[model samples]
Structure formats: structure tokens, C-alpha cells
Target: MEHRITLNAIAHIRSSFPEKFGIPRQGGLADTRGNIVFEPEYRDVQAFRGLEEYSHIWLVWEFSETLGRQWSPTVRPPRLGGNIRKGVFATRSPFRPNPIGLSCVRLEKVELDTPEGPVLHVLGADLLDGTPILDIKPYLPHVDSHPEAAGGFADRVKEYGLEVDFPRELGAEVTEEERRIICQLLAQDPRPSYQQDPARVYGMRYADLEVKFTVNHETVHVVKIIRSMPD
Candidate 1:
């Protein structure tokens, strides 16, 4: 077996969350949409020939932010209020032995003739913008779906949800569709478990908008929304 191997980026994900702050802890938890833009050398349409028939695909990507960081044997998960430590292999923490991450996203459409090459539109992705894609594979529900599968420690917080109170007047520039998406993103509760200060307003930079909100008990109140500076 090869102890070391080289991997190249086949594509990069373009999503609303450029930073890691507001990303969901797991994939398929939010309604966020993204585009998987292929790299120059791997832009051949033949590569994704039958991919359109599949409803979902697995994304093997790099943990770009933790590229140069060292891996720890144990990590404190935010779901557990960062108090208890679990083995790195037992958790989905980005800091790992291999900075490789995997996500299963619903494939919405396949644009074959775009000037930017063939692009795959996906939904329910929890990845950051410009996240490098290492590989892509079709998700076969016949074997992938496990209704009775146990999720281990993560199951305790599987039902994560928060009531979002987003006033319509906050971001008038945001389209109705965008407003709905923002509300869904906020419902996922982006704040760390330990930070429960109701007065401490937190800012989430998603796409072109800056969403400011505060958590008080079970509800998340949107305090402000503004157009952010372009990347």
C-alpha cells in the first residue's frame, strides 16, 4: 500500500458561505445551493455523462482551511458545547489526519454548455466557497440509504433547530427567494453551542449579504442585514 499519494483539485465549489463561520455542521442540513465548477483539464463533458440521472452525488474535497494545520487525536465538538473531547475519527471535525472532507449534496441540474465549462448545480451543501474538489461520485440510494443506521454520539443533537425571527423590512435589497434562504440558514443555528449570550450579536457573511443576529433562548432574532463588499 502506498503510504503517501498526491491528489489534484478536479473542481472548486462556489457557494454563499465564503468563510467557515456560517456553514452547517453537516451536509443536507441546509437549503444552501452551490455550483461545482470543474478545473480546466477536467472540464470534459464526457466525464459527467450519466451524472445528470443521479439525484445526489458525493463530494470529496479538501479541508482548505486546515491544509497546513496539524491533526489532533481528539477534538471538542461544538455540538457538545466544546466541553467533551472525542477521538478525531469519531467526529466530523475538519482538523483530521487527512484534510479530506466528504459531503453528499442533491444534484439539481447539469449545465453542459456554459462558458465556464460544464457546471453541476447542487443543493443542501455545507461547504465554503472556493472549496477545492478532489473527486465526485454518484450516490446510489440502493446501497447508501440506511434508515436504521445509528449515528453514535452525534445522534443526540441530530434534531438541531432554532426559531428564526427575520423581519421583512431588514434587508429590502434581498429578493424574496434570498430572504427565505437566509431564514433557513439561520434556523440551522450557526452559533457555537457554548456562546449563548443573548446580547452578543453575531454576524454571518453569506454570499453578498451580512446577516447579523442574536440568540435569546430558542429563538434567533435578526438584528440587521446589509450588502457586503464584493470579494
Candidate 2:
């Protein structure tokens, strides 16, 4: 006996990330800032009725970058310090029998326009730019949120607060709103758990400012923030 599954792309995400390496490991971890451009054929405004009532939506997408001719049954999860291997089904690793990815993102707004027809303004998406979106479903909090959910081997991961120090030169350039977003992102401690080097500088673009930091074990301390000068 044989079985088959066919999926179609309904939309594509437009984001700042063109590469996968730096994409957030999980959705809702990064600043909410991405757009979903629906295929022109599916752009009927009537299709989006009452969607605004939901704060979040679930994106079922293909792991386009990880798909291969064969798949391994076991995968190394970054959460496990990249040392232990886990069964593919037991983890959310992209290298699976089916390279499907799930992300729950905040729905900022929706627009019906001429270019892409209908576009969904979403925040906190971890997907790369031009990622194929297979389906969209409203998040049902009652069914999705679990207070007692177990995290397996990842339970021991440490949470650290970011220590941000703004340089005087750059400090004067940032707007209040930009600073708030940077603080929010830093509070989450964006560095990988396996990374412990204190000398390495990591930077990410937040609005007009370039934030750089170093991780000393579980603690993330800000090193520098340079605001790009206006052209």
C-alpha cells in the first residue's frame, strides 16, 4: 500500500531575511515584522471577513531550504546544546520525513491592494523572505496554550536578561519607539545557548540602529549600538 500528500502554496512571506542561518529558531521570538502576500488567485476580499477578530494566526509552511532527496530518522536539536540527538518526530527540527514548519504569528493588519491583491501584515515570523506558505489557520488559545506542557531535554535552558548600554553617539540618534523594540528583543536573549564566548560580537538591525552584543555564558551584555546616519 502507498499513501500520498499534496500541498499547495497559498502565499509567500516577504521579510528582511533572505538567508536561513540567522532566522529566529522559533516563531514569536523576533520582532513582529513581516508580510504575507497571498497569491493573486486567492485575493478575494470577501475571503478575509472576520479574520481581524483573531490576534494570532498559524502558518503551515514548507521548510523549502531543508528539503532533500532523503531524510534522517534522528536529528540534533539546537536546544540540546547541539550534542544530543533526538527522534525526528520528537523535535521541531526542519530535517524531517516531511519538511513542514509551523509558526504562530501576530496578525498586525490586512490590506486589499493592486499589487499582490491581498496581503497580511504579520509580526514575529521566523520564516525567511519568500518562504512558501501552505496554509493559514486562526490560533485557538483555549486549545493551543498549555501551562503544564513538558519541554523534554530543553527544560534546563537558562533565561537571561539583556544588559544594554547605549553609547552616547548612538544614543542620541535612536527614537523612543526604536529603543523600546530593541529592549524587547534583547530581553529575550537572542544568542544561541551553545554559544558561550564573551569576545564574539553579534549584531542585528533594529529599525535604524545596529545593535551589537556579546554573550558570556547565559548572560547577554550589550556592547555597542550604532545608529545608521540618515542619507
Instruction: Say which candidate scores most in lDDT.
Output: 1
Question: How many collisions per candidate?
Answer: 0, 2
Which stretches in model 2 have alpha-carbon errors above 4 Å? 172-178, 203-211, 217-231
Q: Candidate 2 lDDT, tens digit per residue, 155-200?
A: 6665445565555565566766666556666666666557767899
Q: What is the TM-score of each candidate against the true structure?
A: 0.96, 0.82
Model 1 per-residue lDDT tens digits across residues 91-183? 988899899999999999999899989999999999999999999999999999999999999888746678989886885868887887888
Q: Return the TM-score for candidate 1, rounded to 2 decimals.
A: 0.96
- lDDT score for residue 150 of model 1: 97
Which pairs of residues have clashing backbones in candidate 1? Answer: none
Under the 3 Å rule for N, CA and C atoms, how many clashes does model 2 have?
Answer: 2
Please give the CA lDDT of all the candidate structures: 0.90, 0.78
Pairs that collide in candidate 2 are: 32-123, 32-124
